[model samples]
Target chain A: MGPALEVKDLCRGFGSRRAIENLGFSLGHGEILGLVGPSGAGKTVTLRILSGILEGTSGTASICGISVASGNRKIYEHFGSVAENHPLPGHLNPFEYLQLRACLKKVRDGRREATCALQACGLLRYGKRYRIGQLSHGHRQLVALADAILGRPSLLLLDGLEPRQLPAVLGELPIRPAVLVSGRNAAEMADFCQKTIFLDRGRVVVDEKREQRN
Target chain B: MFNFFALLTYEWRRISRTSDFFSAGGLFLLLSGLLFLFALLCYVGKPQTVSPFAFWLGHGWPMVLLLVPPLSADSIAGERSAGTLDGLLCASPAAVLLAKFSALLLHYLLLWTVALALQPLALFLASLRLPFPLWSGAELFGALSLLPLSGALYLSCGLFFSTIARTQAQAMAATFVLLFGLLFGPSVLLRFLPACRWPILEDILVRLGAASQNGWPDRFLNFGTVAFYLTATGTILCLSAVFLRSRPFH
Candidate 1:
C-alpha cells in the first residue's frame, strides 16, 4: 500500500491557542488509519481541513493528489466525510437524501448508486422505511456513513464514531478506499486499524504499525 | 453547466419534497390571496378603480416586495447554518450561487405566477374581461417586466444577506429592513421632502419609475430600470460569491 493522502505540518488555530500544530501523516490506499486521541486532540479539526470545510492555518493536506486548498472545483469529488453530529436534512428520508447526494456528486445513475451505498452500509432496510430524523441515533450515524460512501469516493473521513459503535453496519463499511477514522479509544482504534496514530495536545505522539489485515 | 444543473435538480427535489412551499412560501400565498380579496372588495362598487393593472399597481407587487424576503431569507444562510455548504464545495462558489439562485428563483417564480395570475383571474370573473394587455401595450410590457425584475433584485439581496447572516431569522430580518428601505425609502422621502422644488431630484425619482400612477417613464427608461435591476441583482450575487469564498469555513 502507498500513500493516497498526505498531511505535512498541518496547523490550525482560533484566536490564540493552536488547536492542531505541526501535525503530519500519510494514509495509504486500502489502509484504515485510526486517529486516536483524547478529547480536543484536534481530530475533528484535521478532518475538517482535509474535507476543505476548514482551511488550515499553515501546511498542506492533500488527498489522492488533490490539495484541499488548491481551489480545484472538482476537489471535493474525490473525498467524502461524515462529521461528528453530521446534520442530515431531517425532512428527507435516508433514500431521498442519498439520491440527492448522488445527484450532487454527479453519479451516473443516482438512485441506483444510492441504493447500493445504502446496502453497503447495511442501512437499506431502515433507510427505505424512515426519514433520517425518524431513525435512532445509531441508525442516523449509519445513514450518514452510507451517504459518504455512496459515490465511492477515493478518500473517506469519519469523525466521532466510537470503536465498534455501529454494530449492525460495522463490518459493512467498504474496505478498499483509504479511510481515516477518528476516536478517543486506543483499544478501539487498534482493533480496526493497521496504523494507529496517537495525538496529545496538538502533535502526534505515536504512530504504531500493526500486522497487515487479511 | 452539468454540474450546476445537477445541483439545481437536487435543490428542487429537496425543496419540493421537504414541502418548503408551506413555510414562507405558504405565507406568501396567503398574502396573494388577500391581494385578490382586496381587489374583489374594490371591484364590488367601484369597478373603475379595479383593473388587472390597478390591483397590482395599488397592492399586488407591493405585497410581493414586502413578503418575498421571508421566502428567500434561507436561500443560502440555511445551507451555511446546516453545515451543508461544504457538500457543494466541489463546484466554484459562483456556480453554487447560480444554482442556488436558480432553484430559489424557480420557487419564487412559481409563487409569483400564481399570485400575478390572480389579478387577471379576478378581473375576468368580476368584469368579464381577461387581464392581458392589462394596461396599454407599452405600459403592459413594462408592468409585466417589472414584476420579475423586482423579484430578481429582492431575491439577490436575500441571497447576499443569507451568505452573510449566521441564521435564517437574521437573514430574513436583515433582508426585510433592506427591502422596506428600498420599497418605502425613496417614495416616502421624495413625497415627504419639499424637495419637489428641485427639478433634478424629482427627475431622478420619475426616471426611477413610479410604483404609484400608470407610472412608467418612456420605453427607454423602462428598459433602463430593468437593466439597472438586473445589474444590481448580478452585482449582489457576485459580492455574495466573493464573500462566501473569502469567509473561512463556517
Candidate 2:
C-alpha cells in the first residue's frame, strides 16, 4: 500500500567527501522513474544504497515497505538490481549466470525463468552459445538488465545502462515493475520515465514530473 | 538451503575449470612423479633403507604450501575484482564463504590424493617386490587422517586473506607470506636466536614448526594438534565471513 520505494534524507559519505547528501525520493507501484546525473553526482551511490550493497551515513531507504538497511535476506526478494560496471562470471554463459541469479532469488523453476529472462532480453541464441565474457559490451549490459528483471520483482534498480537500450527493455516486460534507472542522458530518460530527478554534486537539482514537463 | 548448495556447486564448477588450476596441478603431479621415480631408484640398492613412501610423505607439505595459496586466493578477491561480489551479497556472506571454502578444500584434497596415488602407480610399473618394513601403515594413516584438518586450516587462512585483499594477486601474495611465516618462522627463529633458552618458548616453537607438523605424518595421533588445527581454522573462517559481510570500499 505504501510507495514501492521511499528514501528520506538519505546521506552517504566516504570520510570527508559526501557521495550523496540528504537525498530523498519516492516511487509508487508500476511507475518508472529516471535518475539522471553527471558522473560523481551520487546516482550510482543512491542505487547501491537502495539495493543494500552499501550503507548510508544517515537517514533511511526502503523497498516495498522493507527497510533496505535491515540486513534481512528477505528484503532482496522484493527487488532486483543491476550494478554499474559490475562483471558477470566469465566462465558462465548467460543462461548459467541468470540461473545463478534465479537460484539466489529463489525463483521456482529456476531453469525456466532463466531461459525466459534471456529470451526477453533477445539474447536466447547468444546466451546459449557464448560465455558472458565473450559477449560484446552492449550484450553484457543487456544480460545485466535481463538479470534484474527476473522473478518479476516489485522494484528494479538499473544503473549506468545506455539510453538506447531502454525501449527494447521496457517493450519486453510483461508487467512493468517500479523501475529507478540512472543514466547521464536526461532527454532520453525523460521519454521513458514519468518523472526524472536530476542530481549534481550529490544534491537534487530538479525533480520534474510529467505534468510539469507538459 | 537452495542458495547455499547452488553457490557451492557454482564455486566447484568454476574452480575445477580454471586453466591456472589445471596447469599448476599438472606441474605438481609431474614433480611428484619425478620425486617418486628418484625414491624408487634409490630403493633398489637397499631394502633396509627409508621407504620411498615415507620420503614422499615428508616432502608433501611444501608442495601443498605452494599450491593452496594460488587456489584459495582467487575465491573472494577474484570475485571482488571481477565486480561480482555485489551480486553475490544477496546470499548471506557466511553462505558464500562456506561454499567457497568447501569447494577449495575439496579441490585441495583431490590434488593430494592424485599426488599420493603416484606412489602405487610407480611401484606397480617397477614391478619390484619390497620388504614389509619399507611400507608403514601407521605413517599412511597419520598423513591421511591429518590431511583434512591441516587443509582446512591452510585453506581458511588463504580464504581470509582473499576476503581482505583487493585483488587476486595480492591475496595470493599475502596468503603465501602468512602461511610460510606460520609454518616456518618459529623454526627459523629458534635456529637463529640462541638466546631463546626459555623452556616454554622452546616448546611452543617446536610445536609450531613445519618440521614438527611434517613429522606428524609419521606419528599416529596428536589430539592437541588436531584441536589446534580445527580451532584455528574455525576462527579464521569466521573472520573471513565477518570481513566479507562488513566490506569497506570507497
Candidate 3:
C-alpha cells in the first residue's frame, strides 16, 4: 500500500571523509531494486543507514512510513540485512545461529523456521553441529542470507551476493519482501532485480527498470 | 527486558563454546595455582609469617580484576571485526551492550566459583593443615557484591573499546593497556614519586586494588558494594548506549 523503504537526502560522513552524502531513493512494496556501484560508492553505508545500524550525518530514513532514527522497534522488525562480509557468531553452528535469530525476529516455531531457512540456503545438512568457523566463505555467505530471511522481514537488504546464491531467493520471492540488492555486475543485477539504481560517489547516476535495460 | 535477557543468553551460549573463554579460564586457573603453590612453599619453611588462606584471598581477588578485562576484551570487538556487530546493532544498542556485559558477568561468576572451590583445596594440600576459611560469611558476602560490579565495569570498558576499535587485535591491545594502566600504573607511579609519599595518597592507591581495599573484600557482601556496582554498571551501560546511538557503524 506504501513504499517499503524511503530515504530523503541521507548524508553520513566520518570527519573529513564523506561515506555517504545527499543519497535519496524509495522502493515500493514487492519491488526488487538493484544498486550498482563501484567500491566506496556508499552502497553499504546507504543500506546500513536505512537498516538503522548507522547514524546519518543529516537526512531522514523510514521503513514503511516509520522513522528509523526514532527508536521505532517496529521498523527493525520489518527489515532484514545481509552484508557482503558475513557476520555470524563463529561459535554457533548454522542451526543454533539461525534459531537465535529467529527468536530475536519473533518468528513462530523457531526450529522449523531455522530448518526452512537452512534448507533454502543449501545448508540444511550442516544442521546444528557444523560450527560457523568450519564453513567455507560461500557457505558462510549463505548462512547470512538464511539469517536475513529468518524473520520474514518486509524489506530485505543484500550486498554483493554471488550468482549461485541468487537461486536461494527463488523460494523466497513468493512472500515478496521489497529487496534492495547492491552489486558491481550489471548482468547479475539484471538477472535478479526488476530495477537498477546506479550510484557513483554517493549520488544516483542512473535509474532504470529491467525492461528498459532490455 | 525479555529481549535483553534473550540477547544475553545467546551471547553466553556463544562465549561458552569459544576458545577465548576456555583458554582464558584455563590459563587463569593454571597461573593462579602455580603462584599459590610457590607462595605455600615459601610459607612452609616459615609458618609464622603468612596465613595461606588470607594470603590467597588477598592476592587472588586483585588477580581476578586484572584477568577479567582481557578475557572480555574481544566479546564485542570480535563481533564487529567479524561483521556480526551490524546484525546485533539491528536490535537495540542498549540491549546489545547489556547482553554482552551480562555474559561477561556470568563468565566471572563461574570463575569466582572456581576460585572459591580452589581456595580450600589449595590450602589443604599446601599447608598440610586443615585450612581455616579466611572468608567469613561477611567477607564472602562482600566478594559476591564486588564480583559483578567489577566485572561489569570491565565489560563496559571493553564494550566501549569494541565500538571504537576496527579489529579484535586492536581491541585486545587497547584493553590490556587500559587494564594495566588502571590496575597497576598508579601503584607503579606512586612508588617512584616522592610527592605521593603521604598516607592519604597511599590509601587511595591501595583502595583502587581490590585486595587492599578492606571496604571491598570485607564489606563486599554488604549493600554498599551492590549499590556501587549497580550504579557503575548503569552509568557505563548508558554511556555505551549513547555512544552507539551517536556513532556511525561504518
Candidate 4:
C-alpha cells in the first residue's frame, strides 16, 4: 500500500566523523534502486542503517510504514538483507546454509523454501554437492543472494554486491520486491537500475530516475 | 520462540565445527582421564589418604575454570570480527545472544557429561575389591545435579566477555581474569583483613569463596548457591544482549 521503504533526515556518525548525513530516500514495490558511491560515500552505511544493523545517530528509517528505530521484531519480517562481505559458515554446505537462513527468518517449511531458493538461483545441484567454503567467490555471492530472496521479503537490501542482472532473477518472483543495491560502478548501475542515487561524503549528490526500462 | 530454537540449533552446529571446540574437548577429556587414573591409583595404593570419589569431585572446579572461557570466548566476538554479526542481527539480538548462550552452556554441560562418563570405569575397577567403594549413589547424584548450576554462571560470564571484547583472544583473557578474580579475590581479601574486626565480612567472603569454587559439602546441593548462580547467569546474559544490541559500527 505504502512505499516499501522510506528514510528521512538520517544521520550516522562515529564521534565527529559522519558515515552518513541527512540521507533521505524512498522505494516502492517491484522497483529497483541503485546506491552508487565511492569507498567512503556511505552506501554500505546507508544500507546497514536501513537493515537495522546500525543505530542511526539521528532521523528515521521505516520499512513498509514501520519505523526501523522502533526496535520492533516485526519489522524484520518485512525485509531481508545481504551484508558487505557476507560471511557463510564454512562447515555447512550451500543447501544446509540456506535451510539455516530460512529457519532464522522463520520461514514456514524451511526445507521446501531452501530447495526453491537454490533452484531459483540455479545452484541446486552444486549447492547440494559442495560446502559453501569450497565454492568460488561468485558462487558464494549467489548463495547470499538466494538467502536474501528466501522469504520473499517486501524489501531487499544488498551491500557490496554487483547487481549486474539481478533484475532477471527478481523478475521471476511471484511478487517482485523493492531492491536497493550498493556498488561502485556508476555507469553500469545507472543503466541497470530504475533509480540511481549517487552518494558522496555521506550526502546525495545526485538522485536520478531513468525512463522506465521495459 | 521459533527464532530462539532455530538460532540455538544453528549456534550449536556452528560452534561444534570450530577447531576450538575439538581442542577444548580433547583437553577436557585428557584432564578428566588423568584425574580418574590418579583417583584410582590413590584408592588402590593408599585407601586412608582420601576417597577416590572425593578426589575426583574436588578437581572439577579447576576443569571448569580451564574449559568455559575457551568454549565461549568466540561465541559473539568471532562473529563481529568475521563480519557475520550484521547478518545475524537480522534476527532479534536477544534471540541471537540467548541462542548462543544456550548453545555454549549445552556444549559446556555436554563436555562435563562426557568426562563424568568415566566415573563408571572407576566404579567397575572398585568392583574387583581392590579398594573401598568408589562413590555412593547419593554422592554421584549430588555432583551431577550441581554441575550445570555451578557452571552456568561461568559460561554466561564468558559470553558477556565475548560480547564486549573485539576478538576471541581478548574475550578468553577477560573471562579468565574475571573468573580468577571471582574465585580467589575473596580469599585473598579475607586473609588480609583482621578476623576480629571483620567477622561478618569474613563470613560473607567465605560463602562467596565456596560458591565460586563449586564446593560440594557432604555431597549435597546448596540451594542458596543455586539461586545465586542462576540470578548471576541471567543478569550477565541480559547484559550481553544489551551490549550486542547497542554495539555500534563506526
Per-model clash counts, in order, read 0, 0, 3, 0
Which candidate number has the best DockQ?
Answer: 2
Give model 1's docking category. Answer: acceptable
Q: Compose the digit string of candidate 4's lDDT tens values, residues A1-214.
A: 9999999999999888999989999999988899999999999889888887778999999999999888776776788788776777776788888887887777889898888888877798987799887898878888888898998899999887777648667876788889899999988888778999999999999988997433
- Candidate 4, CAPRI quality class derived from DockQ: medium
User: Candidate 1: which stretches are off by over 4 Å?
Assistant: A127-129, A162-175, A211-214, B18-20, B23-27, B36-55, B119-141, B188-214, B220-222
Which of the two, 1 or 3, has more TM-score?
Answer: 1
Model 4, backbone clash pairs (residues 3+ apart or across chains), number: 0
Interface RMSD of 1: 2.5
Off by over 4 Å in 4: A212-214, B38-54, B119-137, B186-208, B211-219, B248-250
Off by over 4 Å in 2: A171-174, B36-56, B120-132, B185-219, B222-224
Q: Give lDDT tens digits, candidate 1, residues A22-117.
A: 999998787788898999888989988888778899999888887888877565667778889987777678887888777777777988888888
Answer with 3 or 4, whichever has the higher lDDT: 4
- For lDDT, candidate 1 versus 3, the one ahead is 1
DockQ of structure 1:
0.45
Candidate 1 chain B least-lDDT 10 residues: B212-221
Between prediction 2 and prediction 3, the one with superior TM-score is: 2
lDDT order, best first, reads: 2, 4, 1, 3
Model 4 chain B: worst 10 consecutive residues (lDDT sum): B211-220
Worst 10 residues of 1 chain A by lDDT: A165-174
lDDT of 4 by residue, B83-149 (tens): 7776677677889988998898888888888887866665576463334454566655655666776
